[model samples]
Structures are given as structure tokens and as C-alpha cells.
Target chain A: MTRQFLRHGWTAGLLAILALLFVFTKIIQPDFGTSGLDSLSRAMLPFAFATAAMAVVVIAGGIDLSVASMMAVAGVTAAVLMDGAGDGMTAVAVVIVLLVGLTMGAINGALIVITRVPDIVVTLAMLYVWEGVALLILNGPGGSATPWLRELIVGPFIVPWLPRSLVFLAVCLVAVWVPLKRSKLGLSIYAIGSNDLAAYRSGVSVGRTRIAAYAVCGLFAAIGGLTLTMSTGNGEPIPGPYLMASVAAVVLGGVVLGGGKGALLGPIIAVIILRLVRMDLTLLSVDPNVTTIVEGTIMVVVVMFGGVLAYRGRHK
Target chain B: MTSETTMFKSVGRFIGNNPLVPLLILLLVLVGVLEFMRPGIVNERWIGNTIKFAIPLAMLAACQTLTMLTGGIDLSAAVAATISAFVMATQVPIVGVPLAICIGLIPAIMIGMVNGFGVAVCRVHPLIMTLGTGLIATGCLQVYQRFVIASGSVIPDGLAWLGTGRTWGLPNALILFVPIAILIIWAQRRTGFGRLLYALGSNETASRISGVRSWQVFLALYMLSGLIAGVTGLLYVGLIKAPSLSLVNPLLLPSVAAAVIGGTSIFGGRGGYSGTILGALILTVLGTLLTLLQMPEGLRRILFGLIILTVTTTYIRLTEQSR
Candidate 1:
């Protein structure tokens, strides 16, 4: 276990960077310990979920460009249902939105597998389709989440100091990621991602594993959408920026885009780091335009660092 | 009966040998359908307009095709083009048109060189590398908008003439596209660099072992993509007259879709620009038809997505069967 942890040292490095950023933020804004922490958690939650969604697909040796679009679709669906139906239908609305996400993801997987098309191409096409569907559902993006639904998702849980988003994230780690990590399917996903041909030769069902990965990706994306709706109490059809941001986060998290590497912890920490950077920029009163430049620079730097590490490992 | 069977077999063989044949046929069929649906579309003015709109897309598709031919992609192509346009539009007032155009293209080429260096030297994935560069380009545009140049600047008369002016009753953009197309076709068919790209994309290790300078070829291809994007952006500014940051943003996906629809393999090593030309024409006509039908924006996007998906899948299946 120690050897494995050492092998994936980037995750540790990222966690340290995240800690530093937190400390720095606290230093810059001394009162950041109060309401700032809650807002920070709320801002980090959606992107954390998005990074996890991309990580699952990347681990299965696939890329889903449609994830942000899926989030938008889910968010809009939840909002529309909540607004149209009464408070009593919140649970049903949540279930239906999740199903929508699953269906979209499954469609992405099915198209790629059945047609023998590249994952990027299939998902790129689906990105457009989902974006269109989101726009069609809510042409102008005017819907509200139920007050109770918002309270359940973002309201304080158990104690005033404990934000609900943090609790939700912890539950995800314990209930979803940990169990999935140990399951046969999860192992199969990693196997396929590492080398699908080899896995197929060894009696692993590559198709099934890939489909499951996409389904899980969709599920997480829906969760992200739900969180976004709760935090903002609204929905937006345009998700192009979020799509790129999630990909950036996934890459920054030390997850190889080619797949079969990295851990969930890395991406979670990476998301927090990214959120903190944005917060810092805002606190510093930097121009919003510089934010894109910073994010892009970070993505390139992380990718180049990974590239150098891989090259060194290969040469050695 | 045997002779007829042999004839049919030969025809199939011919199409399988030349991928562009079916694409050309499809383009013609689409044009015919459009003409039938809207008689006015058959006129020279309409044809000229369609060709004009297709010119920049075709060039962008060509950019995509060149990169794909070398087993890579440039998601920053549109952004590069937009930046080039922004530079030219902003500088034309101060400097003359010729100097401004040259200045604009320099940074565009630089963007490509950077992308190439990352993909070749650093060995980063093309998707992520280009995406990062694209983000950087967008950021630059945002900064430029906020600080340097005012938004919605008009194109100079000289540039505008290049965009919409006619030469011998043919649209100037179309006139420009023909020579560029011819040059690319000639290069791909007859140039050593072109053959190296195909070989490198086909099997990098084999080509490397056989003395192909892989890095040089990658750099050249990426630089060429950037140069083409820059030129396309200038033409796009001419077409639109006002070049804003978002002016050419929508072209990014369509350029990729055009290349794929043209039967250029995304995995690389198996396609050409001839099909891409037809692909651009098809999309331009499809856009015209969609507009004529007066569809809602959402519905139009959905249809565009469906067409891309269906066409790409069909092309892949057909090629696989042929192989």
C-alpha cells in the first residue's frame, strides 16, 4: 500500500497545494473562516462532481465531451419539474432528472459501442444534441428549485458549522466511490482502460465495462446539476464553459486523459484548488479576463509536467 | 448476367478505391434537392452566396484535415483565426491593409508552433494541448476587448473587397478557395512532405525507424493549420464586415463536422481534402435549407447534431465494410 501511494505521488502533491491555498486564502482574508467557508464549499461542489464524472469515464478509457451538456439538461429538467409541479413532487422530479442524465450517458455509450465510432466523436455529437435538448426544454432559463430541495442540498447538516454540501460530498465518497472502487465492475473498468484488447483476451467484457462507466459518469453529472440548481436556484442552458472547466480540472487532478491511471482523491483536491484560485483572483480584484489565462496556463503546466514524468519513467 | 455482375463489381471497386467519389455524388444530390425545394437556390446569386459562406468553413475544414492527417487535432483553430482577425481589424486603421494582414498572421502561426511543440516535444495529447491554447487565445481576446480595441470594429474596404467582391461574375471568396484547393490537392498528391505526413500518421514508430523527421513534420503541419486558420479568419472578417470575438466561435464544431463528414478519419492516415470540399458545400446548403424552413434555433441545432451523427456513423460503417 505504501508503494502504491508512492507511485501516485501527484495526488499527495495536489493535496498539499490545496492545503497551502486554503491557508493563503485565510491569511489574505482573516475572516474567511466564517461565511466564506460555506460559500467556498458550495462553489466547489458542482465542479468536484464534474471532475469525478470525467474521471470515471477517463478511467474506463473513454472521454465524454457531453458531460456539461448532460448537467445542463439535468438542471433544466429538475428546475422545470420543480416549478411546474408542487412541493410534494420534488422527490419525483429529482428521480426523473437523474434518469434523464443516465439515459443521455447511456445513449453516448451505446452510440460509440454499437457503431464502432470513436468515443470523442460520439460524445462530441451528443454534446450538441444535449445542449439543444436543454435549450428546447427551457428556452430562456427561468425556473426555481423548491425551497425544501435547496435546504436539503445546501442547508446546514447536523450542526451550523457543517455545510450540507460537504456532507453530501462525504456521502458520495463513502457510499459511491469507495464501494465502486472495490467492486468487480470497477476493476473491469480499470482493466479495459489500461488495455481493452488485453482485457478482452482475458475474458473481461470491455463493452459492458465501458457502458457502466458512462452510466456512472452520467449519474454524477446529474448530481452536479442538482447541486447547481440548489445553490443557484436556477438553470442555464449554455454549458460550454463548464465543459472545458471540468476537462481542465480532470487533467489538473493528475488523471491521464488516455486513462487507466490516477485516483478520485486527486481530482477532488484539484477541483478545490481550482475553486480557490478563482476565489483568490476575485479577492485580489483581478480582471475576470485574467481568470481564463490563469486556468489555461495551469492546465498546460500540469499536462506538460505529466508528460515529462511519463517520458522520464519510460526512459528509465 | 456475368458481364453485368462484373460491371457492378468494378463500379463498387472504383468507389472503394476513391473515397471522394461518393462524397461528390452526395454533394450533387444535396444540391439537386435544394434546387428542387427552393427554385431560387438554383440561381447564380444564391449559388454565389452559398459558395461564399462555404469558403471559410472549407478552409477551416482543410486546416482540420491537415492536422488529422498527422494523427492530431487543433481545437484552437477557430480561436486562432479569430485572433488573427482581431489583430488585422484593429491594426488596419493604423497600418495599411498589407502590413496589418501580415502582422495578424504572425501570432496565428505562433499559436500553431506552440501547439506543435507541445504535441511533438512534450508529447501531450492534441485535444488537451490545443484546448489549453484555445482557452489562452480566448483569454487574450477578452483582454484585448477590455483594454486594447473596441468591440465590433468594421473591416477595411480593401479587406471587405477581398471578402465579398466579385471577379468575372464569380465571388472573390470562391475564386480564392479554388486556387487554395488546387494547391492543397497538388501538394498532397505530389509533395514529399505530404507523403511523410501520411506515413507518420500511419505508423509513427515505423516512419521514425525509416528516417522520417517526425517532429519537423508535426511542427510544419501544425504551423500550416494555424496559417490557414489565420487566412480563414481574415476572409471571415471580410464576409461579416464586423469581426467580434464571438464572430467565428460557432465555426469550430462545424469545421470538425465538415472534415469528418468529408470522410477524413479522425484517427488519421486515411483521408484527403477533396471530400472536405464537398462536405463544406453540403453543410452550407443544409444551413440554407434549415433557414428556409424557418425552424426554431433549438430545432435547428438538434437537426444539425443529428445530421453530423448520422453522417459520421454511416461513413465509418461504409469504410469499415469496404476494408
Candidate 2:
């Protein structure tokens, strides 16, 4: 319906703006274009996975603030595992990263369900805990991945223009999208997020669905972490704060903070918009420190606009 | 049942019922652990300086807690503090220190009013509205000071002495915080406005239905937060004697952590200032202990983040278990 399209007009508009800025940045900062685009693609890939992961949770009416932190956990775990093992151990390490993400997310979901604490608190606490665990494990930063494993996983390829990270992200999106659009599990997730009580009454497995959503969130965060390590060629503990930024991005992307509104495209667009803002700030020669203020302001404004629109739509 | 028996039973129930008793006990245990970790950490100098360092955060927490108590957050406290710091830095020598401090308080209060108006009158979510105010305040400071104020600049000896002065082995800031705390506690417990806030926080619709002027109360609470943030800025001037924009963002979380850790429910209502003060002490002491241990910055960050997570998770678990 045209009404449905109108409902998502803000998202479409933001995506267009982002596309323009991407080109504009390319024109203005052509020197850093290849590297920046590479970096953006690399950086955006993981968050893209996170966005997909967050999409499900949001559809279920929960927000996952622990994605970035969980990503750190997975990345650190993967790197640490790779460092300790022989060349043959890379596949095993990758599997372990996925498992850790699922476990962490499961804990998040279980806590949220059992305690009835707000998702914000649950996710915030997890963000800190996982980051600490990452720090505890990594000790500092820069865990080494096996050279061959790194080559295969993160190395540049000739056949396709797409980076491995891009392929990984695309695969994740397909993996999530196909099941989500086609499966009963996806419907259950939406049902639970929209109204837990209603979903429960309707015989949906609220606890299992929420747990699954969180597990998926964790899995995505890991993929993001791996992508980040591959791009940076080093692990930096600093991106710990970005977990919240990712959440803000998701919210800005048009995903409703309270769970069951918005689409995958919204957060993907939101991330691009945020990246564009950062790129613009860089173009303007603004102090990087001030970027925090700008990013926070943008997030708050976007959420406020979303809130107002939601309020109006309901009342109207 | 006889009246005497019923009275005895009620008294027994009251003895067992207060939430503050358990919270206080928990706080004491945590403080004890910190003291044990650092031998003589509770010594006179350590105690004095910790309280002194905690004063600005405590004051900010008091104001922030008041807003949170009203079902809103005051994100502009840090910015208001920066603005006040900027005013004190620029104006202290021009206008005498006393007048300068008074001038510093003005913008903070005004900023608070703006937050109140936006949220209460404009119907903006407190998070978004205050964030906007925070940006404006940050910009005002950034633009006014041109990014950084020079360190160790001359301030009035009299004002600097107030910052450095001690009474009963307590830094003036710490001593100053006590009376403010007392006054706040009095205001919260005895005043009509305080009751109005609790009423509003517990249920806005019920309060609105009951004829409480919720908007005016909201405005006052937010304005009060700004006033406190201004005071915090003035204290920072005395302590550091420079307005550093770097201090603004860091203070925001620690203040929230102090308020929340001290048993102020993020949901609003069911809390008091004493808890926030205790929470401030806990955080200040934790920082002191980490520094005394000579922990690296990264490690300290890791520890701080872990401790906050641990405390918050424990709080969540405890609250959930109780329910």
C-alpha cells in the first residue's frame, strides 16, 4: 500500500542521502577513497551482519546493545584460538567464535526473559561484561590470526570485485532473510516482540524465540568482529563503546527501539547515514572528539523523529 | 486481636520491611572490601580527597537523580558544568570570584529550564531533548572557549582558597556537599514539591488526574539539576582551575553510575539522595584504589567497566530475586 510506503519514506530518504554523501566524499577526499571505501566496506560488513541480527531482535521488540562487545569477544576468541593452534585449527576457531556468540546471546535472552529487566539494562551490562572478558582474554590489543587462515578468510580476491567481508555479509543477509521471511520461527519472533503475552496466549514459545533472537544477535556480532580484525589487521579494544553506537544506528535506521517496527533496510541505511556523517565531519576537518557530540546528537534526533512519527501514526 | 498485640505485630513488620537497611548493609560490605583492598584507604587524607573528588559528581548526581525521579534524565548536566567552568574561567578575575561563581550558575539553570520545557511542555522524550540541550551546551562551551582554556591560569586567591580550604580534615567541596545533601534530603522528605515529584514519577496520569501541576514540578526539578551542575562546574574550577572540554563526556556516565548504583531505580521513584551519595563514594573510592594500585589506563578502564557491569548485574539479579 502507498500508506506502507509512506510509513517507510524516512528510511528511503536517508538511504538516498547516504548514497549522495558517499559519492560526495569520493569527490572531495579522493586520496583516501580506495582505502576509505575498503575500510567502510570492511567495517560496514560486520555491522551489516549486526544490523541483520539486530533486525530480528528488533522485530521481536528487543534491542541488543551487546553486539559490538560480543563481536569483540568473538574476534578476540577467534584470534586467540588461531594464535594457539596450527594451520589446521582455523576452521575449529571459527566454529568456536560462532558458538561463543550464541552462548553469550542466549545468556542475554535468558536474563531478559527470567528477570524481566528492561532490555537496555540487560544489553548494557552485557556490553560491559563481554568487553571486560575480551580485555581479560586479549590482555591488551592485537591478537594474531594464522597467516594462511587470514589469507583465505580476509585476503583480497581477483575473480570478483567484492571483498570476502562483503561476501560474508551478503551470505549472512541471505541466510537471515530467507529463514526470516519463509519460516515459522521468524513469525514467532515478530509475535513475541510485538506482544509477549499475546504470543504466549497464542502458543508461541516466547522464551525460546527471545533466546534464539539473542543468539542470532551474538552470532552476527562475531561475524562483525572477524570482519573488523581482517580489515584493521589488528584488534583494537577501543571499539567497545561502539556497541551502543550500533544500537543507535539500528534505532536511527528505522528499527523501533521497543522491538517490533521497522525493516532491515532501515538500519542498513542508518549505518550508511552515520558513516556518511562521520565522513562529512572528516571532510569538514572537525575535531574527531566533536564527532561524539555530533553522533550522539544525530542519534537522539533520529530516535526523536521516529518517536514522533510513531506517535502521530498511532494517533492519526 | 487486642490493640496492643496488633501494634507489636506492626512494629515487628516495620523492623523487617525497610529496603534501605539491606541496601545500606550491602554498601557497607562493598566499602569494607575496598578498604581491605587498600590498607588505610579510609585514612584521613584519602577520605578527605575522595569525598572532595566526589563532590562534583555527587552534586551532579543529586540533580540528575531528581530528574530521573521525575521519570526523565538530565543529560545536560555535564555540558552545564562545562558552561559554568567556562564562565568561571573567563569571568572570575573580571568580576570578583563570588560574583563570577554566581554568574556561572545562571546558564546551567537556564539550560535545565530548557530541558524541562522541552520534555514537559514540548512532549519530547527526555533522552532526545536533553541530548539536544547537551549538544547546545557543548557547542556553547566549545565556541566560547575556542576548544580549550589554558591550564593553571590565575583565579582569585580567595576562591582558590575555598577550593583548597578544609574544615575538620574535609576539603571544602566535601564539606560543602554535606549541607547541600542535608538540604536536598530535607527538601525531598519534607517538602510539597518533593512529594509532587514522587507522585508524578509513580504515575503521571494519576498525578495529572489528581490536579498536581506536573509540568511546573518537572520544570523545577530539571532547573534544579542545572543549578547543581553549575555548582559542580564552579567546584571543578576551584579543583582544576581550568575548563577542559575533555572532562564533560567522561563525567556523564560516572554521574549516572553513581546515582543508579546507589539504589536509584532507572525507572524513577523509590529512591533518595543518600543512596546517590553512597554510590558516589563507592565509585570515587574505586577510582582511588585503581590509581593507588598503579594500574595502567587500559587496565583501569577494563576494571571500571567490569565493576560497573558487575554491580549493575548484581543489582538486577537482586531486584529480580526480590520480586
Candidate 3:
């Protein structure tokens, strides 16, 4: 029972802190009531999807540092394709955008499985290779996402109260979390993450499962990337920082780096909390530098705590 | 059995066992292709200058190989290099050039120590820990750049010569390469430290059980990696004669890639610096050839990605086949 409590405690703690931050920010900055919430949601919405994508891979016991790069590549691909489509092929280009995302994801998954390289190294390499590829494609093309597409991505959903991107975000959460409950593949992922050799003994195809997990991660990243393109309406050369931010979200969300243990919703909240951290810092007029320091301190401390947890768990 | 015949067998065995052979073959292949496309591409000037450009990267790859050998990756190597470059450039004018170079090693050693402590003593994973340090280093870069702005600083002309100046028709950068390569080779083949690294890489648990002090080895390896990155960064700054932060982007990929292709197992254990140097040379030549081919940067990148994917796959397949 106590173990379960500790398991849930990571997410609960972040939630509590998030609530405090939101409330405090609201109180201090009178302007934060509605617009702040909107900004908060706006800032977090795309990352929310990205975090979900990160969570799937993390839960499977691998890390995808390339999520940001995939997002960048996919986003740029979609934008450039849309731009080049010349109005007649806009719909076809959108389909192409999603397809390119899938292709990129497959590449990531394929490379990880075949090379058997550490996920970090493989993904870090992919992050560069893909981003370089994206930059080369864009090549200072200076394209923009369409107005309608931007509106669909940025505007409110049917409720007219929540962001439109929140709809896709909802679909993403359901798509992942639902299957996680229903599918043996999901359980096997958790098993593989916990102990791959043991999982292999238990009749799971570790390589296939891992590849699938990375593909799903790629898919999520691509989706996130396309959404971000629609929201921002531009392609970017530098996508690593934002990608690292998502990585920070995954780690902060209590997904253990070596894999096999973490909740889905935790990363979502982590993304929000991280965005809020930035928002709160901005609200309080704290130096953004302090935020970096705080973030680094938090990552090092959390990773240490995770080590402690794993150490104690092992001994126990 | 005759000693000469026995020696021949050992020499053949070493060639067969060494990772450098494959990388050398790759380099030869690259030269062949470049020559095929444009004859005399491997002329004395081209070869010497290529080696000069290749040295800083090769040094960095050697450091990366050592860290990766111990089952850790040093993402901060580039940042370390960048910081060192910035520091060297900034300090050389204030202090004497030689003194500036020596002082610059301090930051690299310190960053390395921090990485070592965090991973060894703190028990933090190298990735997260170095990432934090990497970020801190990046911030320091920004801070130092701001300092440069405030102080109106510039790297000294004499120090800049370390990058550009040549000796006996050979670039000074190439001079830095030989000693570093010798030291890396010595560390790997002629030392207890190399054995400890191999043992740690092969089996950390057994190595620890056998009293190898795996953590200490890790600490030392990380420190070495950092120190090497620092020197590499200095060389880079000297070469460019300015601290270009963008260099980190290209450096990170190729450094890690060179180590991998040079036949260093990314999983750690079972590789050498000789292969890393050869790998760096091959990759540098490949990139240069791509430019020479007049390929658009985009096509070149796509091709580079394909090459990486192909190389890693081939490396894995070859190992599997051997097993």
C-alpha cells in the first residue's frame, strides 16, 4: 500500500505544486485570470501531445531525445509541403505531412531496433540527422502554415471554451491510454522495460515491441510537430531546445529513464507544470536564467531521487 | 616455429582484430570516389589540409570514444569544447597566449570532474548529469559572450596561429593530432588504465566484484573525455580564429558518429582511438567530397542520414555475422 502511495506520489506532488503556482500567479498578476489560463493552455497544448508521445516510449523503457527533432522535421515538412502545394493540393499536402511524420517515426524505430544502440545515442543522432534533413528541405524557403489550418490548430474546440488543439490532445490521450489498458502489447512493453531479458524469456519479442513503441513515439512526435507548425505557422532550423524541454517533461513526469515505470497523465501534467514554471517565472519577473538553473537543479535532483528509489526498491 | 613467421601471424592477427582497418578502408574508398569524380583530389595540399581540419575533430572523437567505451556518452563535449574555445579566445589577449592555453584546461578539467562526480559519486546517469552540465556550460558561454561584448575582447593573434599556422608545410592543427593520438593509443594499449576501462566496459558488475573500482575508472574516463574536449575546443577556436557557437551542432553528431563508425561500441567496451581517428578522417573527407560534388546541402544531409543509418546497420550486421 505504501509502495503504491509512493508510486502515485510523484504525480500528486507535481499537481499540488502546479495548483499552488497557478493560484499564486493568478493572485499576483490580476491579468492572469482568463488570458493567463488561455496562454497557459496555448503554450502547453502542443507540448501536451509531445509529452504523451514521450510517455509511450518512456513507459516502454526507452528514451526518444529525437522527439523535438521529429516534431521540427514533421512540422517543417508539413509547412513546406503545404506551401508548395499551390492551393490545389492543400489537402493532399496535409496527408503527405502526416505520412512524412509516420515515415520519420518509422526511421527512428527502425534505427533503434536494428542498431541496438542506446536509445539516447540513437535518438540524439536522429535528432541531428533529421533536423539537418529538415533544414535542408526548408533551405530558407520561408514558408508559412495556412490561415485556416492555423485557426483550426489554435482556436477553441466545439465547446468554444477549450483550445481546438485540446481535441487532438484528447484523442491522443485516449488513443494511448485506452490501448494501454486493453492491450497485452502495452503490458508487454511495461514488462520489457522492467527487464528485457526476462521479458524475452517470457515470450515477448523485445525488438519488435521496442520498435513498435518507438514508432508510436514517432507518430506522437510527428502529430505534435504538425500541430505546432499550424500554431506557429513556420518552420524552424533549431528544434533541439524545445525537444529537450519535452525530454525534461518526460523525466519530470516521473517516467524513469531506464523505462518500465511511469504513469501517462503524469507527463501531461509535467508538460503543463514545466510551461507553468516558465510562465510563473515570467509572471514574477524572475530571470529566465533562474528558470534554467531551477530546471537543471530539478532534473539532477529528480534523477538522484529516482536512483535512490530504484536502489531502495532493489534492496527491498 | 620461426620468430619472423610467428611475428607475421601476430601482425596479421592485429590487423584482423583492429577496428581501424575498416575505417581506413572507408577513408580509402572516400578518396577513391573523390579522385574518380575529380582527379588529384587527394593531392598533397588537399590531404595535408584535410588532416589539419580532421585533427580537432579526431581529438574530440578520441575523448568521446573513451567515455562511450565506459558506457557513458558525453553530450557536453561540444559545449566543453565551445566553452574552452570561448575562454581561450577571451583569455589569450589578457594573458600570454601559452598561459591562456594552460588556463583554459582548468575549465575543461573542472567540468569533467563535475561530470565524473555526478555519475560516479552522485550515482546519476551520465546523460542527465552531463545534460545539466551541458546546459550550465551553454549558459556560461552566453555569460562569457556577454563578457566579451562588455570587455571588447578578441582572441590573440599568436594563439590564433595554433589553428592556422603551419610547420614544414604541415598545419599546426595536424601537429596537435599526432601527440594526442599517441597518448590515446598509449592509454588504451600500454596502461593499466586501459585494462580497467576494458574490464569496466565488458562487465561492470564482475569488474567491480574483481575490485576494479568501476566508479573510479568512470570518473577518470569522464575527466579525460572533458579535458580532451577542452583542448579540441581550443584547437577549433584557433582554427576558426573566432568562437563560433554553431560549431557545436556539427561537432556533436560527427564526434559521436565517428566514435561509432570507428568501431567503438556505443554500448561501451571493445573499441580503440585508432579507429576513432580514422573514422573522423573518413567522415570529414566524406563531407568535403559532398561539397566538392556540388550537391545541395539538403541532399548532402539526407545522404548523410542514409549513410549513418547504413553504417550503423552494417556495423551491427557485421558484428552479428562474426558472432
lDDT of each: 0.85, 0.73, 0.76
The weakest ten consecutive residues by lDDT in model 2 chain B span B146-155
Point out where model 3 deviates above 4 Å. Answer: A81-96, A114-129, A132-137, A153-168, A237-240, B1-15, B95-99, B245-249, B319-323
Model 1 error, position A71 (Å): 1.2
Task: Please provide, for model 3 over B104-220, each residue's C-alpha lDDT reduced to its tens digit, 9 standing for 90 to 100.
Answer: 788888888888888886677787778877776676666556556654447767656768888777887766778888988898888999978877778888988988877788788
lDDT of 1 by residue, A1-316 (tens): 9787777788888988888998899888887864676788888888888889999999888999889888988888888888867777998999898888777878788888887878887888888888889899888777989988787656577787788888888787667788898999889989988899999999998887888889889988998888888888988777736677888888888888878987788888888888889898888888878987897888887898788788888989
- Alpha-carbon deviation at B301 in model 1, angstroms: 2.0
Indicate which candidate wins on lDDT.
1
Native interface contact recovery, all models? 0.61, 0.15, 0.33
Worst 10 residues of 1 chain A by lDDT: A152-161
Of 2 and 3, the candidate ahead on lDDT is: 3
lDDT of 2 by residue, B86-185 (tens): 7766776567667877887898899998788777665666755786778656756665565335433345665566566778897876567778899998
**Model 2 chain A: ten consecutive residues of lowest lDDT:** A152-161
lDDT of 3 at B131: 81
Q: How well does each candidate superpose onto the true structure, as a TM-score?
A: 0.96, 0.83, 0.91
